[model samples]
Target: MPRPAEAALLSTSLIPTDNSTYEALPLVDSESLQALITHEALNASALELFAIANASVKEYGHPTRVIGSGGHYKTLGWIEKQLKNMSDYYTYEKQEFKALNGMVFNHSLSVNGVKVLDEKPFQLTPAAHVYWADLVVIDNLGCEDIDYAPLNASLSTNTVALIKRGECPFGNKSSLAGKWGASAALIYDPESDEIITGTLGTPTNTTVGTLGISKTLAESLIAQKNAGVPLKINMFIAAYVGFIKTKNIIATTIHGDQDNIVALGAHSDSVEAGPGINDDGSGTISLLNVAAQLTNFKINNAVRFAWWAAEEEGLLGSNFYAYNLTALENSKIRLFMDYDMMASPNFEYQVYNGSNELNPPGSEELKQLYIDYYESKGLPWVLIPFDGRSDYVGFIETGIPAGGIAAGAEGKNSQNGEVLDKCYHALCDDVTNLNWDAFLTNTQLIAHSVATYANSLEGFPLREPPKVASSADVPYKFNLHGNFYIM
Candidate 1:
């Protein structure tokens, strides 16, 4: 989508794949407001930005974007300097990662006479108490009214509880079941379809060493009970606390009405296992591209651009910012739009379902804005549940209306197809692993959304005080080696 420069004005000395070519690429003039908001202009910017990231990876390594690392800090600093060159409205904030040191669990269960306990180091419930116990399946889904009576009437002493996932907070389910005499708890998808992993809300938070299970396993155990077969399972968990320091980069327009702000964000850090180019490089670069173009135009309502850190580590960076805001500061934020992954190799256009599921007041309007854009373009899109899988987690938690788009992540390309973004969270998610078409398409949408709200917050509702909720209520399903569970 990049426009070719006039050959006479361009030098033939630089190689297109070289970093020098990226440095030599033309950027929109700071006063060119007309060029700034145009979709083609932003897409062109994104192409060059991607070149910069590819260069960063080449200079560093596959795991180059880990938070607080020298490579990550230096790269982020370079970006900050670029923003400063365009405008003087940027700052950085540092936060401790508050390390969740270690979690080890020994689980044992029998399915159809097959003993399936491999002694894996399962993720622990935050601050969960150390314990070992036999397990029992609760009669009611583990969402509400979890009393010991049903658990007691179903199983004997020291029996762990297996409850379906829904309704109440994850920690709440374990806490309530523990109150009723269960030594530990296991929460699984009600449909028994996926593997789920999540935080227990906070580092110091405690619960009954709860474990998330696959819907398949839970259903099997339930069927065994129904067939008058005995179901005995054992689970043990141990955990400790620790911290890592990270930083967040925030930029705001100095010329707009600062009282009513529109914020957009994307996580900049990658996962521990990979470079996370598609997982987040896509989102990070898209916003950076938008931010660079926006410097060309003045706005009515102030717009803030945030490059969050440690989002893959359970939305830590955004959580710190939102949680630390004063009521007045929070209210100034009309809405928060999050962009995580935008160019999965096996791509699908996904718009966050802000209106119905995570209805943070004005979220529906934001959702419709995206829907209308895709519809107008004659491109099909699916509404994805606004689960707290990325930085938007913190924004929605703060009751700040939020919405955004994603190409695809580790999910399937279709019901019968392979995993979307085959290299997701893998080392292969490098410079060559993106869908350029999807990337440009989504980048244009980012420009549209940011420009729309920046010019006017008309239909975008104002914010009220936020009541943050635990993210465990919305389960993320994962299929590991064909074993599906919530993550």
Candidate 2:
């Protein structure tokens, strides 16, 4: 018996482009270090530093080399050797702060060492007496039992508060805390065990100081407060404020005679944690592969691929590029596709149809396109509610057609009766943990969909006049089943 074609998939070569200038844009060379940054080992500052240093050295007349070879691409010593190899072109330097800054410390203390200001289960001493802190520490303050009106009043004079972890949600707590007059808030762990960190939603209203600390440190601070000991702790934090310049690397290929454009994008910036391979490296690589495969195909409408920067800092890069477009350019845009996290082993695939309230112009057609492509390939998929969680937010906000696929993220996965990919936004999200089979399949689907849309003669496959629907007219009703929802 012979092996099936899908079982023995062969890599295809990208079609050569006549436009040499656009071809010059780097397109996922295996040697590129962008993939390595997905490991969560490198923080955003380090990634930025690496990009700046690499660009500077390249311009300084050093041998044109791929920057991804350092770190995981090679052995530690080999990585050092590569850096040394480029030493002639650039100098590596680290700056130290005069004050304890850019550093976070975790500490724990015995229960005997701490004092209880209040016998009540949750109440703690006021922030004024705690540490003369720019902010006060109030751990585990949630909305359920605890009333925040008093705390909010107390915080107005102090301007800062640190809440211990657990109980209520962070966003709700942050919202309540903001009402109480806090400039910033830190949520530390109660167990005093491992470091606790997670996403703090968009800081739209108030500038609330947010930080994660270990349970050990929280307990230690509590103990000190109880003992009436004047506790002195040190922490170093660094943030750069003001306008920073970044670029949106755009690579496009036009096939057919259509005037409309279909855009696919993935942000390249990693958070201040590790290389963001799963965070977005997976999406970036998938799109890059799609681009490489499309190079050979001639299509009608333009297919534009982009690797955006500064996405970690509030979608700055993508927003800037999308909004900065001229009237002519905006009109030419047909649909925007975003691939943020398209590969998580534990969760099923989903398509984000921008806002259920309104079809949002081109979303319904794009959703059908994804569904049809998945069906053609005999794959199972689900449609998820529209979320402005990625670069797609910009396009949707501007009334441009937008849709994309997400494998699984940090949320729970009801279909498989499993937790959502736990490694999301963590240092554990490396390639070793990915389900490559799913990755490959999803990547292929993305490429096929883009190619079909670009080749179709009906410039934009989506309906031009937006469809209006009332709650009674809506065809699908979602039923919540355990952790998963059935549509």
Candidate 3:
């Protein structure tokens, strides 16, 4: 990392002067921007900017930032609360958190529509493991899983073996059944009527779809067969994992027009991979710097600075905010600007190519604004696709004009690529992974855009206000998924 004094001096010296081509406002002064990034570097380590973050988790067991886990949300909440306490000029709104609880497996067993087993929330089978088959009780008791001899060649093709959960692990039983050509395996609790959930632990060459049924259900099926009553049963299983309680920290200036808002966002949560300091801490810190500095001046249009949650999980936080907005609320958003990886170690300034076909109206003009700013500063920049891969996806899909910048990620790390960010999403993506020079320059660009739009949206387009659906019209209550990589 660069020395704080040097970084501050270098940052301050590059503050762009007002040009005749575009009218600029001093919403954030040069001195404050320098101080903010300097403060940023000084406080980096204390921020716990690394993977296996929580000492408590490490002391107790392995440290991993699993989505919706205690360590993950707790760290994020603390950071947002600290930022919330930083200023009084901006009003804060913490979006309600949502978490993706364990999957609710819906399954059933029906004998010619007699409904032998009713559909209910069951345990999650392994992902991509779905099946329907006739039940076959291999009452081998202590040796059902190990003794495949009980399941002979005469068994039906749709066979689903029923075994007691005792002698061996769940994976062993499922493996045995799968080897015998059984379509699925039903593992039941030996002592109670309660259904038990189990995992296959890891991938295996032959692992069948597995479910847990109660002792009562297993016995009843056994009795029917003992009574010489021929039974034909059906089974169904499915699983989904998403939407946990995570928040978006939104702080808007109280001095500007709420009707014409200039929104700036950076995702707060990091991936399960690492603390994501350069991948996003750089962007988050940049926004915080600008937000803190902007308190010194007022604006004509509202500047809403947002630190979105669950961005690592597919832009869910931003998507939830945009999806729930009414038409009037959508129209109030003049534009949205996103800041993702602005300080990649091996960096290249990437401006979103809003001139492309993916984005809605007004994106090209926003793209041009960035192009002009970089050109005026004599900086080298390249255009990246506007492919709805970032938080801007939600805003653009809803007709809110959006633009932003990025410093390359994993995909842009090769000889043929414009730039290479080798530390993209790994544990190495810490504070040291950021190039301070690129960090300061991109942050200044963000400050310029924020100030320009907050002061006035003079050159931007004016079209019919956005048409957002009513609350009842949206199919899902929230949009949640995770896997969009940094550009």
Candidate 4:
């Protein structure tokens, strides 16, 4: 990695004073970044959950609740408590922490529908009359101690598997379950509003299931079993099956009355391991702060904010959200700004220019946005090829303009003027490992571009999509699945 002092000096020295286009744009403040980091560090529920599981806080003499015992609980209440603590610590007034009833299935096990195979231990078999097998009730299972071997074996034929939702990695378990054969997986928590979906890894040869249930559902099923009552479940897996219910949380602020919209987004869900602070919490929090700060600011176009879920699972969330939009909605979307990993401590930042040769839909304008920000702030940035690794993939493939920023990640070598942040997705990605100044600067740049695009009288100046070259004209053709275009 570049020396901090050198990076700072180089960044400051590169300011472009001659540029009159964006001279008056506001820069991100270090204090804001510090405040965000502090808040994220203290309040991020994901991080706190991991800390409790790993017993990290136990060493500090304040042990967190366990997964299943009397004092052990995982509820939205606990999450709210943590959020409140952080808000109080940071003095954030009017802070509202809400855990929405995100999604529901058509078949969630209920006491009146399932036939108990073994009444003593409570084993169940579905009734023939039930059309939709939405819920699966398992006899004895804990998210932590459940034997996946049986579940894996059963997945080959089972559309859904009922499992407890504590102590296990939902993403990995869900992937394994999917690999075996299940169409969807449900993990109910004995305690909280932590309704987690299973993380799907890379696309598989066979498309089986699409969604995962929360721990709360599992607890409900267990209660039904204990009561010796059959459970009835109504399951509505989103039409985009094998990947159902994945969603992108989108919010928009119109600059003026412009029809064109500049979309800025980041995937909100993290890998099941940690709260994904650096992997995405950094980006999510940054975007939130920027949006909050820019809420009243004047803009000419529309600035949209989206927090995507299930991105860690093969970009399913964003893909579903983007593809499901109506034709009118698609036409209104002018540009896509994606921020995936934006605060890695190991590497210098990079801006992805849609493609190397021709600019992608909104590549040029996005590039100019970053360039203006860096030049005005005297920061050094490099433009690279779009790898289609994040939520922007759907937009770019649909020919919508797309560009994004990235911090470092694991396996990204510190080569070609890039430095690697080794702690990319590990638990070590705490605030201490981050360069707050860089984070703040990058956040400001993102916010500024969003604001600029919104305020510009001309809608996002989109370049035509690159022409599809014939196979003969193509130098090399890799057997890739999606469309690859130049920016």
TM-score of each: 0.64, 0.60, 0.61, 0.51
What is candidate 2's lDDT per residue for 231-274, written digit by digit as tens?
43222233312232334455555343435777888766444344
The prediction achieving the highest TM-score against the true structure is 1
Best by lDDT: 3
Clashes of each: 15, 38, 11, 38
lDDT of each: 0.62, 0.49, 0.63, 0.48
Model 2 residue 270 CA deviation (Å) reads 1.3
TM-score of 4: 0.51
* Residues 1-487, model 1: lDDT tens digits: 1111211111111112333433343432222432344445434544444444444454335344555445456557656666756544333333333423233323444433455552222233533442334456776656455345667675467677877766555656776677677767777867425454444433223256666667777777778777877655545454543455556777776556788888999887764335667768878777877787775555677888888776655666776677666667778899899888887888888987877343678888988988998898899899886755667765666678888888887578765476777776555776667888788778778888777877787766667665534335422221110101111
- Model 2 score (lDDT): 0.49
- Give model 4 RMSD, 1 decimal: 16.5
Residue-level lDDT tens digits of model 4 in 240-338: 222222234455552334367778887555443333556676676667666665533345566667766555545655665555555556777777888
In terms of TM-score, how similar is model 3 to the real structure? 0.61
* Candidate that beats the other on lDDT, 1 or 4, i.e. the better one: 1
Off by over 4 Å in 2: 1-148, 152-184, 188-208, 213-243, 355-357, 457-487
Better candidate number, 2 or 4, judged by TM-score: 2
